[model samples]
Target: MAIFAKRALLSTGWANNLRVEIEGGRIAALHAETSAQTDDVSVDTLLPALANLHSHAFQRAMAGMTEYRMAGRDSFWTWRDLMYRFTTHLTPDQIQKIASLVYMEMQEAGYASVGEFHYLHHQPDGSPYDRLAELSDRIMAAAVETRIGLTHLPVLYSYAGVGKKPLETGQARFGNDVDRFCMLVDQAKDALGNLPEDCRVGIAPHSLRATCSGDLARVLATHGEGPVHIHIAEQPKEVSEVMAGLGARPVEWLLDNVHVDANWCLIHATHMTEDETQAMAASGAVAGLCPVTEANLGDGPFNGPTFLNAGGSFGVGSDSNVLISLTEELRTLEYSQRLRDLARNVMVVGEGSVGQTLYCGAAKGGAQALGRDAGVIAKGKLADLIAIDCQNPALCALTSEQLFDGLVFSAKDEVVTDVWSAGRHQVRGGRHVARDQIVSNYQRTMADLLAKL
Candidate 1:
């Protein structure tokens, strides 16, 4: 297959009248300054689509229900209690339906892939399913239906909090000792056979508060090849817990103990100290930022400027799946920084387009975090790409260099016209090809879910 774009952002820079060829789900060739062929899929604007590096697809079903304030203070911990209760109502079939909807929405919003940080692994009573990876298989089924590239991170969650605590009732479905967690990982890898070659499995130790060092080491020993993601330092309470229990802050302890490298993605390192921020940048890991969900949970803004100045890599995700817009994620990131510092353009590495820095930086970082050979329109890369309507009202007057700025700041997912996940071409005309069926299934599932609640 081939695609001709009037304007495209290549790794080198923006170019005009480019032709991209794909074979076996990877870009086979690129012709710059070229004319469109008769059979090509012509598009208005083309760029490398991003990966949602962190997600809990089931949470999308609970988006609006958790917005109202509780009796007293409301924070991530309170919201999490609600999430745990909601999980009890979801069966494997319903998990598949919700994930299909989430993946379809992601592709339609111009994300080429997702790193599902999955941990829901058992029955509501906290017992293992007959198939250890049953829920994992459901997530894979969703990916297969959506044809969205997936790097499934089967989570290893054992304890409820720091100090090697036992699992609470709400966390029972997510608990697994090191041995059981490793078994789950093996089954998840086996389940990957049902997905495309572009899809693979990785391991995630939910967080420091959820797993101890010995178990984390055990899991990482056998399954350390693909992407390894973990939650770290998203809240002050979490940091304090880790500091009290581990004798160091979360990021500091992990960096010192673990062999932190490029293959690791540290999700929500929001409350890092200056020293921790610099050291984390030097660790060659991607800071998986989910600004929309962070804001929704009242998590603090990330140490963006210091991390960027230290030459860190970062990516964006719809962590809680409360909302899944690429534009709003990037915009919210910048706005959070601005609100913190009382200045604009704080996310830029230097004096350049804030939109470009945010979007392009995240594109590259997201690919690396997912272990994907994508994030740029170059030959021999995965054809993980999106095409947007440059003539859309929000983007009509922008130049090629300013297009990302316009898209990130002024536009919405409606501007995205087509998306290809490793050449699958799952979304077109601003909709997933299976939009009607997926939405219908989700609606029915939601109806049943609400009635049960």
Candidate 2:
């Protein structure tokens, strides 16, 4: 496939009248000052699409159902109770439908890849499915139908909380001993035979509270070379629990014990101290920030300045699927930092465009977290890319340097006109090619699910 762009953000910098060539799911060549061919896809602007480095695809169905003011002092713990109850009624088919909708929205929003932190592994009663990787296979099926690059991170969730608490009834479907979890991971990896070559499996140890040190080490030992994600320091209560049970804060404990490197992605490190933030940045692990969901769940703002000053790498994700706008994800991240520090342009590394820094920095960091050889429009990289219509009202009259700023802060995702995942042109004219069927199936599935609820 050949894509001729009037303007494109290459890794080095922006250039005009460039043609990008893709072969074997990777960028094969680039020609400058190029003319568009009759069969080439012409675009106003092109950029490297980002990977959503942290997601719980099944949670997309629970978007607006948890907003009621229930009882005293609503908190993340209280929200978890409601979420746990909702998970019990989901079937494998329903899961697939919801995931399809989520992945479709992601592609439409200019994301070419996702890191699915999947944990709903068994029947509602906690028994393993006839195929141990049934749910994993369903997730893979959704990715296949949507044509999105996937890093399936099957979670090893052994305990309900810190101190190895026994699994609650609502948490049954997510539980697995170390041995069973490893087997499930292996089965999940084996089931990826039909997916695109860019699709692969990773491992997630749900949280420090969900698994002890010994079990975490065991699971990590098995998956030696892929991405590893975990939840950490999203709430003050969680921080207290990890401290009380594990004798250290979540990030501190993990950095002290585990050989955390570029392969690790610590999700929601929102409550770290200065020391912990510096240490985490020095370790080369990416901080997987989900600004929209963190705001929805009342999780505190990440210490962005501290982390960034320490040379940290970070990326944004649409966690909880409450909202899947890549524009909003980057906007909310920067806005959160501003609200915290009472300053403008707080997310930038230096005295340049905040939009470019946030957008490009996230692309690079998210690619690393998902183990994807993407994040930049460059030769020989995976052809994960998006094209935008600069003539859109939100972007009209903007200078080339200010284009990303407009996209990030001023535009919704509608400005996105095309998306290519590993050279697969699945989204065009700002819609996924399979949008109608996926939306129809999701609506039917939700109607049935709501009736059961």
Candidate 3:
């Protein structure tokens, strides 16, 4: 496959008139200052596809169902209660349908890969599936159907709260003792063997509140080197709970106890103090920020400036799947910072455009978190690429320098015209190749699931 772009965002920076050659799903060569070959497919603007560093694929079906005031005061906990009610009846086939739609949307939204933080493990009756990897296999099948890169993190959710609290009724489907969880991990890895070559399996100790320190250490010690992810400090209540239970903040506990490094992705480190933020940046771990979802859940502002000043790497996720727009995620990140700091371009690093900085940060950190060789337009990297619609009136005047800013801030739907994930043209003309079938399956699944609920 040979692709020529009038202008493209390269790892080195923006370049003009470049061609990318893909061989064996990797970029074999990049020719700059070049004209399109007769055999090349030409486009206007191109970007490296970003990894969606956190996701709950099944949650996509419940996007707008929980918008009402469930109680006097709504919080993440309350929202989670509703989520539990919804997932209580999900069958493996329903999960597969929902996941297919979600991954397809991710590719169309410019996310090449997903770090699926999966925890839905058992039957609604709390019985283990005949195949322990039943749900995990479904997620991998969705990735195969959608042609999206997958790094499945089978989550170990042992407790309902901090300090080894017993699993609540609503969480029965998620429970796994350490031994069973390890077996689940191994089974999930075996399941991936039948999927795409780029698919991977990892371990996620659900959160500090769910996994004890001993089990956390055990999983880290036994699980071979792969990406490790965990929910952390996403709300003030979570921070308060961690402080009371562990005598330290969640990030603080991880820093003090675990050997934090590039392989770890701390999802939603939203309530960090300056010191914790600085330490996290220095630890080389990626902070997985789901800006749109955080805002939707009313999670407080993260200290983005402090973290960035300390040279933190962060990636974006569609967390709740309430909204799935890569541009909106980047826009929400910058807009949230501006709202917090009461200043414009608060997320801009040095002289780079805020959009460019956000995209690059997410790209690099997401690939690191997913343990995939992507997130850059370079030789030998996966051909996970997106082409922008330069003919969009909003982007008509954008120079190669302003292209990212224009797209991130202004252009809306249909702005991205094409996408290739691992050299597969999964999206073209702003729609997934399997969009109709995926949506139809999802609609039927939702009808059945909701009717039961």
Ranked candidates, highest lDDT first: 1, 2, 3
Candidate 1, residues 1-453: lDDT per residue as tens digits? 999999899998888899999999999999989999989999999999999999999999999999998799998999999998999899999999999999999999999999999999999999999999899999999999999999999999999899889899999899899999899888998888888999988889999999999888888888857899999999999999999998999999999999999999999999999999999999999999999999999998999999999999999999999999999999999999999999989998769999999999999999999999999999999999999998999999998778889999999899999999999989888999999999999999999999999
Each model's TM-score, in the order given? 0.99, 0.99, 0.98
In the range 370-416, model 3's lDDT, one tens digit per residue, is 99899899999988898888889989987777877888899774788
Q: Candidate 1 — which residues are off by over 4 angstroms?
A: none
**How many pairs of residues collide in each model?**
0, 0, 0
**What is the TM-score of candidate 1?**
0.99
Which residue pairs collide, candidate 2?
Answer: none
How displaced is residue 112 in candidate 3, in Å? 0.7
